[model samples]
Target: MQAQRQLLFGMYMDAMRMDEVIEHCRTALITRRPILLGVLNAAKVVELRRNAALRESLMECDLLLADGQSIVWASKLLGRPLPERVAGIDIFSRLLLLAHKEGRSVAFLGAKPDVLAEMLHVVARRFPGLKIAYSHHGYYEAAEAGQIAAGIRESGADMLFLGMTSPKKEIFLGSYGASLGVPVMHGVGGSFDIMAGLTKRAPIAWQKCGMEWAYRLLQEPRRLWWRYLKTNTSFAQLTAREMFHPDHPFLAGANHRVTSGSPMLPDAQLRSIADD
Candidate 1:
């Protein structure tokens, strides 16, 4: 399928709805075609600007979806509105249900050892009949990645979920995704913690209002306060630059013609620029 992508924050953001993403994964699983799924949010957007390796890894993804409500809002403000936010945790849950229903096997590769075990237990209870092909904690050294990837490959899993933080998950998948042979690979970040009941997701209202980050900050102020402050401020500045400065290098070579509430370049032009 031809991807409908928008150049948002210097990345090609897939304009895919939740159902479309699920269907794409379904097709990939059936065809044994690999899809390295990447998700972007305010924090990641800020980090990518400074982290060349992480940026390169994310750019290698076959699908890149907006994982933060702020990203969707930014897209609209920048006149390249995405359909909606496809949060990583939501997709991870949906995929688990899909795997359970289809009797497909999945592999988990991240989280503390006990947390991983607890997550597996939760999965078995919550998603009975969901085949677990392999599982491991995220405590291994960089040198052991090849062996771990080899084990995942031999597990015959249809999907692999990494519970590690970025850019560890992104870099690992970028390095070993093809060799792992999994049809669908997703870096789910803290979804495993949520599954294990070690962390709580923000309420639906907070999520809808795009205040999930604030809620998270409230949960762990010391560890995340400064990080969120720095990233959120940086992301807001970046978005503002794109909004007020169309001639900026990030949006270079684009004709800023607005049509139907979107200031997107023609599809042909976007394709040409993406090719370069």
Candidate 2:
């Protein structure tokens, strides 16, 4: 069964609940068909306006989910209500459990070496039955991406999770995801840190109220304050424009180059942008 997609903020977001997403992933794994999952938050929605490469990479995704409650609220305000915020961390955890229960092997890429090790340790204790096919730190040089992708392909993993930040994760997947032979690929930014206990997710109250960004700002005010301010303000403005001027050209979706069983971008270009 195909989930309904709602076009909001110039992108088509799958209006799927958590259970549906998990079932879709299970089917993808069973069928051995690739499902490149992407997610959008308020910051990403704002970034899409200026980052052509990011926008293109995201458009290539087979499923795009609202990762921020603000995005869900925006959808409701725009008359296209999404089911809920499918936070990347939540989905990552669910997929791990699913893989464990199904006796499927999974691969993990990204995060610092130490953090990756800690996360793997935690995963082993939490899901003892899950098989880890391959694991790699996110600090490899740009030229090493091919070797990394090859390693994942050879490991015979059913699902691959990337804990790197965007648009690096997006670019890497855009360049090499088709060749990796992984049925399910998810870019789960910062989830490694959370799993390793290096960072804490906001309380459920903060998440429900769409104040998770504020909680993050409180966690590291010096580094995140400016970023949140700029992106949040831009997102709010963009949301207002979409709500008030539904026919505006600026709100129109771009000519997206969706994935067609091929790499989204050339290796050279994707690597160059990823290095930037």
lDDT of 2: 0.82
Stretches of candidate 2 off by over 4 Å are 247-276
Candidate 2: residue 145 Cα off by (Å): 0.8
lDDT of 2 at 91: 93
Q: Pick the candidate with the highest lDDT.
A: 2
For residue 204, model 1's alpha carbon misses the true position, in angstroms, by: 1.1
lDDT of 1 by residue, 108-221 (tens): 999999999999999999987789999999989989999999999999999999998877888899889989989999999888988999988889998888888788778978
The Cα error of candidate 1 at residue 23, in Å, is: 0.6
Question: Which 10-residue span in candidate 2 carries the lowest summed lDDT?
Answer: 267-276
RMSD of each: 8.5, 6.4
Question: What's the count of clashing pairs in each model shown?
Answer: 0, 0
lDDT of each: 0.81, 0.82
The runs of at least 3 residues in candidate 1 whose Cα sits more than 4 Å from the true structure, single-residue gaps closed, are 1-3, 246-276
The TM-score, computed over Cα atoms with residue i paired to residue i, of candidate 1 is 0.88
